[model samples]
Target: MENNMNGQTAIVTGAAGGIGSAVVTKFIESGVNVVAVDLYQQALDVLIEEVGTSGGEIVPLAGDVTDPLLAIRAVELSRSKFGGLDILVNNAGMGSDMVPLWEIDLETWRRDIEVNLTSQFMMLKAVIPGMIEQGYGRIVNTASAAGMEGHALSSPYAAAKGGVIAMTKAVGKELATKGVLVNAIAPALIGSGMLDQPWFDEKTKKQLLERIPMGRVGEPTEVAEMITFLASPSLSFSTGAVFDLSGGRATY
Candidate 1:
């Protein structure tokens, strides 16, 4: 909530999505410039128009996070626009159909991994150098509760998110002494468009809501607030960790 970020800059993937847009807005409120990246041009445009920054600014870039060039372009925009990059939020992801692991096709399985996991790796690979050179950076990976508990009928999505958590730990330790902190957040049943997907029938949604002791889904703004702190200079001495945002649903 405190506006400590005066001249900081960041790149946020899935910036047009519910949680992603909220994260961008929070950063901008805290006086941090943000380069918002998403695949849909219309969505990016609509977001840019709606969420006009009050203090800092948002630079919307329409591109796929899976593309290697998109990562490079985002990094360059951060440097050129805001002088340097300070934070990177890998928040872009989607779920596949509600099918058993054995029943899913190979291509769908691979696509799930690419969008949910490999894309995060690619972004981190492109952004870490600038952070290393500066000796100060914050990286937040958006993981899912399914990854931790291995949700039924969403094996590919679960597997990819699990990989994200592990990768965050490995990279966080690798840069622990380098002044760049990396962490992940595992959220369950967020109240977003994700719940409207065809994979989530009324029964499926009800079953998921029952898991949260709070009896409700998490708000995107709540996740954004946590992300703002982790991406700020105030977050010291914590890295390679997983933050829980499951409304009391996280067992671990």
Candidate 2:
């Protein structure tokens, strides 16, 4: 696929995680300048050092993705460093506790919503204006199959990702005629930091894998490939859609 994305600029949240780093590397290889965002400076530094500067420019801006101000700073950094922004990957998210909805605390529920859903909204709020002014932009949000099909014990996560799917559709319609395309990806299970959590014990992993017909977890690079497509000019005419990376787990 000819992305035709050379020299374009993007802001990728969760730039240091498994999926995030893979997306950053893929974008860089596609010749897209990136303003990588993550919470810890050290992690971002490690990712930058690993990906290197061989394909396109990459600069890190460490901050909490839940912070609205971080979104503004990231936008400023992208514009100043790469001239203007052309893409956004709202991939910064986390897994909630393995407890059922009734067992989950209010703080945990609120945090999950804030980090997964509201943070994406904050980024859209910060970056959409410039994209609208330019009349061209690509946005690929990271949702989850949990949003599409409810998870047994992860209500907050499911709720937040469901909100992302809804928000993506709304924004896509709002910007459809303005040359800005907004879409989302829903993946059931991909090897990432989320799986490394203590709650994801062997039994849980086994159950999750059993749901996938592929019989194996997806790699981060695979997710990156699809996200890169969505962020490229190659993905015109599809907005507010959710691309599945579910390993056959998603029936709809």
Candidate 3:
């Protein structure tokens, strides 16, 4: 299928991780230049080296997503390097420790909210003005099934992802007539760094997998494909919608 994404520029947060890198690679293959953002310089360097040979241009930025300035810088970098920003992938996020809500520390809860929810807000704040001025844009925020159907022992992550879903809906409606489409993806148990954390032990993984009627975990590449579609002109007429990647687990 023709993605109609050639020569466009995008900023993808969490660009060094499994799902993020997959999205980056998919974007490049579709002829899109990218401004990739992540927390570790070394990981970003490795990502650039790997995807640099793909097809489209890619520049890497290492910074904390929680820092609002990083969002501004990323938007600026996309314009300065690639002429204009056409897409924004709010993908940078982390999972919280597997613990009861009462057992979670206040700082941990705040961190979870900061990384998963506030960071997306910052990116939207920075990128929306340019997109509005140009009268065109595509935004794909990464949400989670945990948000839709709250997860036990993971309240903070659930709450933050839920916020992402709500925010995407609100923004999508606000830009529906401006030729800028905003949507979100709610993925469950994707094979990524977020799952590789120490908290996701065998028992947790097994339990999550069993919840899926498909009886398996999702691949990062699968997620990349869906995200690429959402970020393309081919997806016209859809905004504030949430696509599911839950291996048949999402009933809504």
Best by lDDT: 2
Q: How well is each residue in 1-252 modelled by candidate 2, as lDDT tens digits?
A: 688999999999999999999999999999999999999999999999999888899999999988889999999999888899999999999886688788988999999999999999999999999999999999999999999998889899999999999999999999999999999999988998989998788999999999999999999999999999999999889998999999988887
The collision pairs in model 3 are none
The TM-scores, one per candidate, come to: 0.98, 0.99, 0.98
> Candidate 3's error at 137, in angstroms?
0.2
Kindly provide the TM-score of model 3 when superposed on the true structure, using C-alpha atoms. Answer: 0.98
Deviation of model 3 at 91, angstroms: 0.3
**Model-by-model lDDT, in order?**
0.92, 0.94, 0.94
- Candidate 1 regions off by >4 Å? none
Error of 2 at 216 (Å): 0.8
RMSD of 2: 0.7
Residue by residue across 1-252, what tens digits does model 1's lDDT show?
A: 563777799999999899998888888778889999999999988888888858789888999888889999999999998899999999999998999989999999999999999999999999999899999999999999988999989999999999999999999999999999999999998887798888789999899999899999999999999999999888989999999999998887
lDDT of 3 by residue, 52-97 (tens): 6667899999999998799989988998998999999999999867
Cα lDDT, model 3, residue 96: 65
Candidate 3 achieves a global lDDT of 0.94
User: Clashing residue pairs in candidate 1, if any?
Assistant: none
